[model samples]
Structures are given as structure tokens and as C-alpha cells.
Target: VAAGPAPPGTAPGGRRPWRQLALLSGLISMDSSESSVISVLFPALRAALGLPLSALGTLVAVGKLAGMVTGPLWVMLAQRVSRKTVLVISSGLWGVWSIAAGLSQNYVQLLILSTIAAAGFAGGGALVNGILADLFDDAHRGRAAGYLYAGVAVLLAVVGPLLGLLSEVHNGWRYGFFLSGAVTVAFGLLVAAFFRDPGVGAAENPGVGAAENPGVGAAEPHRGGPARPGATVLNRAVLRELMSSRTFRLILVQRFANTQLAMVSFGVVYLVDVFHFDNATASLVSAPAAICFLIGTALGGQIVDRVQRRLPDAGRLLTWQLATLGWGVAALLATQVTWPSIGIYVVLFCVLGVLQGFNPGCNRPILMAVTRPETRSAAFAVMLSAESAGWAASTLAIGYAGSAFGLRTAVLWLVVVLNLANALFMTLIHRPLRREALALRAATADTHPRTSGAENR
Candidate 1:
């Protein structure tokens, strides 16, 4: 398919966003499958390996920490090489190792393999967003990102219930991880063999031997002055650019808060412990939350493009997240009720889904706005690194808090605090978002135009 790089002020429903969404969808299946498959198997793992809850908590913490450790290396590399290369190699390794994790016999082996697999998690988030940044001009970034997250939502929807049902069958847990790994590997191969760098004009790649076609447009200009693939994280200027942006800070800070709350959703054991459900039952029950999340994401993705047309500010997006956070907190509070019915539990699961849905849809717009095209990947790395730090900190703090104060009580407090913090950070970021977006718009207007036929109403 020929890519139509419409000049600025082009009509909606073009080809780039669709292609990019396809790319993101394929890549995100790796992540969603990894999480869902394991979430379903956590019970079987306990019996097979004699792993306890605290040990399980430690594994989750370590996986996230691996992302923190490896994110910047990928970012710096993206500046030097194609972000496309970084994503494929890293995520490919993630998929290969994730399968190995399923076959591990001992607890320590699982830990090691999981840590390696998680390393893929860090780099791709920023790199994929960077690819989308390059594909769509700023005017349609919200729509572009919305479409990307919608893909992720779709994958999550499939992974959740599919894995849950599979694990529920006897010995199905053993096969679930293996099949999930095969699926992820297939997706990776598709990306490696068929996926071109989204930022590059199709004319340059000519995957079917068309690069020789003189008609293809000249390779688009590269980001960050064409650093080699081994670029170091010593760019003081990039650091300054990252730190100076108030919006970037909020995105990072709220990532921390949101991740902290997300840590609770990982508590599938709570279903077993409090609700008196078995492992398979708990896993199946939690699938509804994932479904709700995907549904909400689809709705959000469809609307974001329209919203950007009219209310192009970050506040409108934040308002949606704040409401979601509030809903999740209310759901957690409901769990505290004595003799709660299954209906209320289902509603709370939906609440978790709602918050997950709102986050990726709303959050990416704020992230894309603050940084310009030149160093968007590195800028994302900086924010993601900060988020990782805050996430590591909060996970430790909250994990201990849950242990001491009781999981239910600790979570209730955390939901209130983190959402409050998320609200404050969003409010604090207004000037930066507006200012930087205007600057990005001005800079690109000559080349790309400044409208996406947005339909805010």
C-alpha cells in the first residue's frame, strides 16, 4: 500500500495511522500475552515451585525494575539506529525468553528468565510511541496514539479470557505458556519479516526490491542528527530538554502513581484469599476486568481524535483519568464490605478495567505533546526512567504497606493518595503542554501542516 503523506491540514482516516496501529498491535500482543498467561498460571506455579505470595510479589517488583534498568540503553540506541530495529530485536528476545520462563523447573530459573523477558518491556513503549510520533504529524498524534492503544486493548482482551479459560482446564496451565510463547514468536516474525520502519517512507524500504525505484521519495530526514546505533546517554542537551518540560514531569510522575495503583490489580491472590475462589476461578473472574478495560479503550480511542479537534488541551484528557482513578478507588472500598455479593465483585472488576482503559488512551497524548519530533524517543526514555524509579519506589512502599496494614486497607489508602497525586500533576502541567504543543506545531507547520480534521464535538 502506498503511504499518502498528506500535507498539513489533511483529512482524517489516512493510511499511516492504520499501518502504525497494525504494527503496535502485533508488538503489544507479546506484552499482553506475557501478562495474561502468567496471571492465569500464578496458581499452578505456586504448587509446582512452592512459591509463596511474598516471593511472587518480589518477582513482580523485579520485572518492573528490569524495565527501569534497561530502558535508557534502548533509548540511546534508538537515537543512533532505527527505533524499528531496537523494538524488533528487544521484543523478539522478550518473546523467546518468555517461553523459556514457562519451561523453568525451579523458582530461581523462572526469576531469571522473567527478568530477561521483562527487559523488552521498557524500550518498546517509548520506541513504538516514537515511531507513531514520526508517522503522524502533531495534529493527529492523539488519534494516532489512540489507535495504537486501541490495538493494545484488543490484544489484552484476547489474552485475558483466552488464557484464563485455558489455564482452568486440567494441565492446561502447562500448555498455556507454551502456546502463548508460540503466538508471540509468530507475531515477532511477522514484525521482523513484514514490518517496515513506520517513520521511513515506504519508498525507502521497498521490501519487495523497490528501493531501486527512483520514484520513491528521498529518505525522510532522521532524528537527532543521525547518531550511530551505539549513541551514549551523555547528551546534556537532551537531558535539559527532558527536564525543562513541565508536562513531561507530570507524565512521569503520574506514571508512578498509576503504576502504583496498577500494582494492586496484580493482586489476583486477593480473589483467592478474600473471596474464597480457587486459582482457575480467580483467573476467570479477573478476565472480566480485562474485558471492561478493552471495551473502555475502544471507546476512548474512537473519541480521542474527535476530542482533539475541539479541546486540544491535556486537561480534558486528565479529567477522564481522574474520573477513572476515582472509580477504581471506589471499587476497592467496596471490597471492604462484609459478605459482598458476586455482583459487586464483578462491578469492581469492571472498575479496574475502566481505569486501565482510560490510562493508555489519555496518557499518550500528553507524552507526545511535550517533546518535539527530533528527540522524541530519548525524551520518552527520560520520562519512562523517572516513572520506573517512582514505580520501583511505590511498589516497594505499597507492598510493605499492604503486608502491614492488610491488603484491603493498604490499597484503599493508596488509591486515594495516588489519584490525588495524579490529579495535582495534571493540573501542574497545563502551561508546559500548551506551550510545547504550540512550539511543535509552529516548527512543523511549514512541512506538515497543523490540522488533522479534528472533530472535538
Candidate 2:
């Protein structure tokens, strides 16, 4: 009841601290930022390789697909190995590969190494989000995550342009991997050596990994289980639970549709071809948006925790989605308005950044709520699969559309349509969110009878 932490030796507030949450959050974020980082090198790559326009385009798609494949392998391995270790190793590998990429001999070598490095980033991301679920209370996980990613959004905005500027001078694009890899390895070592996951109800446990029900005593050391015969098959129970729960499905679908719209690889080129802005100008437009996104994420996380404390089943989650949906639509519609100056584009971009900010704040908390703590990693891996698929498909679709109908038309159609479809996804989980809200309330009451009276129904 007090503001003081649950106990010494455990995660803060019986959950992890923001610093404790950083390594994975930081490392994983770098993974999903291919759009920002890889784009800086494209012109250099084309000039050096003497490749056609089509060849340059294929690099992006192939890299993402490779990431998707590698992601689940990491998640599955997490069941057998420490999630922390996998992330650390992957990030280490990322560092090595990034440096290797910078020194590649040819197009084929560069392409192969690029895919491998990005895949490490993607898999590492899944591990970090899973760690968040393990370390936090369901009530507060979303907001906590919001803070973590808000920090990342800021980095993307800031580092993205710096990477571009470096690319311009002294062939820095070739060395991008070297810089990223060195930093990544340093981060992985620190995290592997020190990080932990929080289990609930354990008053004095450090949060490297949590117990199934932390409100109780420590769990028996996982000595032995049924001979985990088959290759730890993708846990279907994780899917069934999500499928049965409306909130889970809605969040996942929203994530899917949001990515399909302006959120996907679409942003990198949309500014370039449609808005006819130079790369530096596009990054300039994007940077403010990144700042706004960070603000939105922090706000979302704080608000989610506050609102739930009062109305356990408030429509705040739905509200966030609706706002995001509007932003997507507005972004598409913004394309229609002919902006005369870099100033106008900056204004629109900042608005877009605000909308982008809403996602890290709103989305992950919902996913954690829908899946129980134990299966959080698997649940996220499944969603990661969906996210990767949406990214791949959207890239392909937009590519064809741009070649045929024009970038402007493609952006317009996808943005508006995906916005509406994504908003409707919340409807998919309507009844389930309500049901889960009640179930969570009951569970809370059963565990903490004294606090139940303080919690509003």
C-alpha cells in the first residue's frame, strides 16, 4: 500500500525498474529500426554494386523475412535457455555481424549479413518484451513498457539522422555496422551479467525470472519435466488463449493493421517519392515525430496505470486505439493537402510522430494482459510472427502499388483502409476484454483481499 517498493532484492514496486528494463529494450529497438539505419546505406550500396532499383528494394523485404524466421527460434529456445542469455548472445552476434557487414566483399555477402544482423535484432526484441511481462504486475506492465519504448522512439529520431549525416561524410555508411555492433556487444555483456526477471509475491527476489504465481512462496527449482521430446513446438495454448480472448486478438490485429499502413517500411520512401523531400529533409520531418512519439508512450503508460486503478475495465485501451486509427487516417489525408514548405511537412510529421508514440504506450500492455505471465514469451512470439507477416505483405503490396498506381495513391489507399480495418479489430476482442477485466479483478481479489476494497470494480 505504501509508495515504498515491495521489498529489497526484488524489482522495484514488485516489478522491474526502467534501468533494469533497458538492455533488451535498447537492443531490440535497434533491431526494428532497419528503416532508419539501412536506408542510410542504400545509395552507397547502389553506387558501389551498380545494382538496379529493383535489387535495392528486395534487400528490405528479404531482411525482414529472415528476421521473422529467426524470431520464433529465439522464443522457443527461451523455454529451454534463459531469455536473458539468448538476447545477450543475439545482440553480441548482431555486433559482430554489423561490423562484418561494413566490411563485406560484394552485394551477395552484404545481403546475407544484413539479413542475419537484423534477425538478431528482431529476436532480441521478442525476448525483452517477454522479460517485461515476467518482471511486472499485469496491472502495470503496459505503462512500464510504454516508458521503455518512449525512450527508444527518442533514440530512433535522434540517431537516425546522425547515422544519415555520418553516411554522407567519409563513407560512414559502410562503417555503420561497426558502430552499432560495438555498442550492441557492450550492452549484451552488461545485461547478461546483471539483469533479472521479477516473479510476483516474492518479497525479496531479484527479477531475472519470476515465479508462476509470485504472490505465493518460491517455486520448486524446475528440476525435470516430461522429456520435452519434440522440438519445443510452438505452444498452441498461447494461441488458443489469445483466440479466445477478445482483448488479445484486438491488440494483435491493431498492431498488424497499424504496421500495414504508414507504420511499415512505407515511411522511409513515402517522404522521399511522394513528398519529394530529400533524405535529410525526410529525416528532419521524421525527427520531431519521434520526439512526440516518446511523449505519447510515456503518457500512455502513466495513464494506463492510473485509469486501471479506478475503473478496472475502463475503455482507455479502446480510446488509444481509436486515436491511433484517426492518426493513420489523418496521415493519409495529410498526403492529400499540398504542403508548400518544409515547415508544413514538419508540422504534419510531428503529428504523425505523436500518433506513432501512441503505439508503444498502448499496444504491449494490452498483449501482456491477454496472456498470463507464464506464456507471455510465446504469446508475443506469435504476435511477432503476425507483425513480421504484416510488414512483409505491406512492403510487397506497397511496392506493386507504387510501381503501378503511384506512391501517393498507394499511401492514400493503404492508410485509410488500414486505419478503418485496424479500428474494427478492437471490435474483435470486445466481449473478451470485458470478460478478462472481470477475471483479472476476481483474481486480484482472491490474492489480495485487503486491497480489493480499494480497487474500483
Candidate 3:
């Protein structure tokens, strides 16, 4: 687990990082397939196990709860070992738990096994986002993140219906876990074999005189290097460092309030229960919606990059706020209104998907702009843990509320109202975000004066 130099051909700003990004996206997509199956195949699972609607919330909640603990633990482990090793074990080798979950004969067994699998999967987000920041500079991080997430959406779009079709077969829901686990294992091996660690802060200090490396000049000493044993441990100091940032604090609040993820997690169930669509027919909406999400990430990334360049102080935050507001509007229309056809629902969900895409494109880069490379993984770990906590709360609330007041009423209140509130709340971040970003830039310039001119350009 000793830290090593960057892999051959992985110099800062190299053209070769896209392959690494693709592999990271694939790992995430496969890791996520388990949840997709649960959401899509919940009806079959319920019928087979004789469970209640609230059980869906339990199933989803357990995984998120596990993430809240394991995400930060995994990041700490990566700091001690190497991100590559931690990723291989957490994302790749962890598939065995998924396979075990698939083989469960009852609800309790499935819940236990899925929780174990989720703990390992939780490790990837912090590590992946950390590596992504090191792979690309500020100027291109948006497009890179956009393409990364769009790749995930494309895979989900292709896989969603196929998972839906599994419902047609007896005991087919188990196969979804089996397939997801197998693919996850395969990709894990692929990552171990191919993914190169882009060394912390590599993007900030491109090699001197490398004409091919864009937006950077003269190399400085690498500030972020191999961690000494326990050096990167998540201590009170690390927590204090993260909490001290006004922008980071505001982002955490926004994460808690933004519960739109619960909407998609329950979309299939909503269609099945309220609209009375069968699993197969209901799952069809996942594809077009995913495609639109893909479009949003790809297109939104480019727009965010340009907008940030034009309005460096508030552009990305503004885009994120508007997107959140638009999502609330779409959620109200999609859930509260009685649309005539599934196609109409699909159209509305597509709008929601696109707006959702704008978020990661902006928020992630915002994080990168403010945090130090050495702390980025820890920063993302904390943010994702907050997100998981929010999702767990929102999904559980949705489940109980859906049972009492009908899903239509539950979703309209939880998804629409909270999203609008989150949008308004985002105004608090504009000044802090600008302030922190400038501070980070000034610090980086002081640390690597040779590259400051190129970074500013």
C-alpha cells in the first residue's frame, strides 16, 4: 500500500485522462446498478417477499445509512494506502457481497447482505471525485464531470428497461443483483489493471515545457504527495478545516434540503401505484428520462464551464440555483397534475432529469475551486455522507407519507416544496463561494508561483 509515482503517461494535463475518467464512470455505473434494480424491481420483490410499501424505504435507507459511515472511512483508508488499492477493494472486490445479496431467499437476508455491499460501494465516490479533480484543471473540470456523469446516465438508460423486463419472469429480480454483481466484479478487476492514480494536485502543476499540457506552465514541487501513515486520518482538525469554509458549510445545508433524489428512486413505484402501470411499462420511462439526464450533463457541463468563465464569481452557483428551482417546478407539474398518459409523465421526468444534471457539473467544480487537493477526498466524503443522510430521511418520509396520504401528495410536498426552499437557500452561498474560490486561487499562486500565470489564464 505504499504510495507510488503517477502511472506512466499520466502527467498533469495529459490527453490520456479521459480513459481514466471513463473507467471511473463505469465503476460508478455498475456500483449503482444494484439500486436501479431495487427501484425498478421493487414490486416483484414485494410480491415475492410479502413486504409492505414501507419496506422499500427500509431497503434504500439501510444502504444510505451505511454510506454515511463508510464513505469517510474509505477516504481515510485511501489516504493511508493508495486510492487505486482502496478503489479496487471497495468498488471491485466488494461485488461478492452483492452476489450474496442476490442469493438471499428472504427480506432480512437481502437487507443484511445489501447493507454490507453498500458499505464497500460507499468508498468510491470520495475517491473518484478526488481523482477527477487531480486529472483535470479548473477550466475543463465541468466538461469532464459532465461527460463522466453523462456516461453513467447512458448506461442506466440502456439498462433500465432490461431490468424492467426481468419482472416478467418468475424470480427474475434476483437476476438483476446477479448481473449487477458480476459486472461490478468485472469492472473492479478492470480498474485494478488499468486505472492510474493521477497523483494528488497533478492538475495544478503541469510538467514544465510540456507543450501538450494545456493551461499550465513551469512545474513546481508537488504539494500533495504520498501520505505518511495516518497522516490523512479524519481527525477533529480535518473536520474543523472543512467546517471553517463558509461555502462548504452552506453546501452541506443545501445537501440536506435538496431531496430530489428521492423522486427518481420512487418514480417506478409511483407509476406502479398511482398511475397503475405495470413494472414493464413503467420502467420504459427510465430510458428517455435517463437520456435527457445524459443530455443535461453533457450540455450543461459545457454551459457551466463557459458561464463560470464569463461570471467567475457567481456563474456556477447561479446555474445550480436556477436548476434547483426548475426541478421544483417540474416536480410539481409531474407529481401534482394528473397527466393523461405515461408519455406525458415521461416528458416531465425528462425535464427533471436534465435539471438534475446541472447540479454535479456545477457543485463539484465549486468544491474543487474552494478546497485544497490534499483535502478534496475528505471534503467529498463529508458532502456525500450528508447527501446520503438526506436521501435516507427523504425516502423514509416519502414511504410513510405515501402510505398515509398517497404518493402523489407525498412527492408534491417533499420533492417540490423542499427543492424550491433549497433554491432560495442557495443564495447564501454566492458571496462565500466567491470569497473561498479567490482565497484558494491566491493560496495556490503563493505555493506555485511559477504556474500562477498559466492558471489565471
| Best-matching candidate per TM-score | 3
Q: Write the per-residue lDDT of candidate 3 for residues 118-143, one digit (tens) a residue.
A: 89999988888887887877888888
Task: Give the TM-score of each candidate.
Answer: 0.82, 0.83, 0.92
Instruction: Go through the candidates in order and give the clash count of each.
Output: 4, 15, 0
User: Higher lDDT: candidate 1 or 3?
Assistant: 3
Scanning candidate 3 in windows of ten residues, the lowest lDDT window is 213-222
lDDT of 1 by residue, 1-457 (tens): 4334444432122233465467766686576566555555666666667876555556666777888878877777665655556666776545777778878878898888877877776777777766665455444555566566666656655665566676567656557667767777677667776555534321111121112321211123323222112222427887787778777766676676664344443446666655676765666545566667666666665565556566676544654556555765755454566455555666776776666566555666667665655566676677666766665565555556766776666555665456555666566667777787767555544433323222122
Which pairs of residues collide in model 1? 8-448, 8-449, 80-228, 310-456
Error of 1 at 424 (Å): 3.7
Ranked candidates, highest TM-score first: 3, 2, 1
After superposition, the stretches of candidate 1 with alpha carbons farther than 4 Å from their true spots are: 1-16, 166-174, 200-234, 259-267, 446-457
Error of 2 at 116 (Å): 1.3
Residue pairs in collision within model 3: none
**Across residues 1-457, which tens digit of lDDT does each residue of candidate 2 receive?**
2233345434533444556776556766555444455664454455666754344446666776776788878777765655656777876556778777888777899789877887777776666676675555555665778877876776677776776576466657676667777767777777766665443222111222243323221122322221111112355765576577767666666666654333435564566667787666665655666787777787867776776566556455765666667776667656767778777777776677666666655567666655554556666776776676666666666667766788677667766667667776666665677678678656756754643443332
Question: So what's the TM-score on candidate 3?
Answer: 0.92
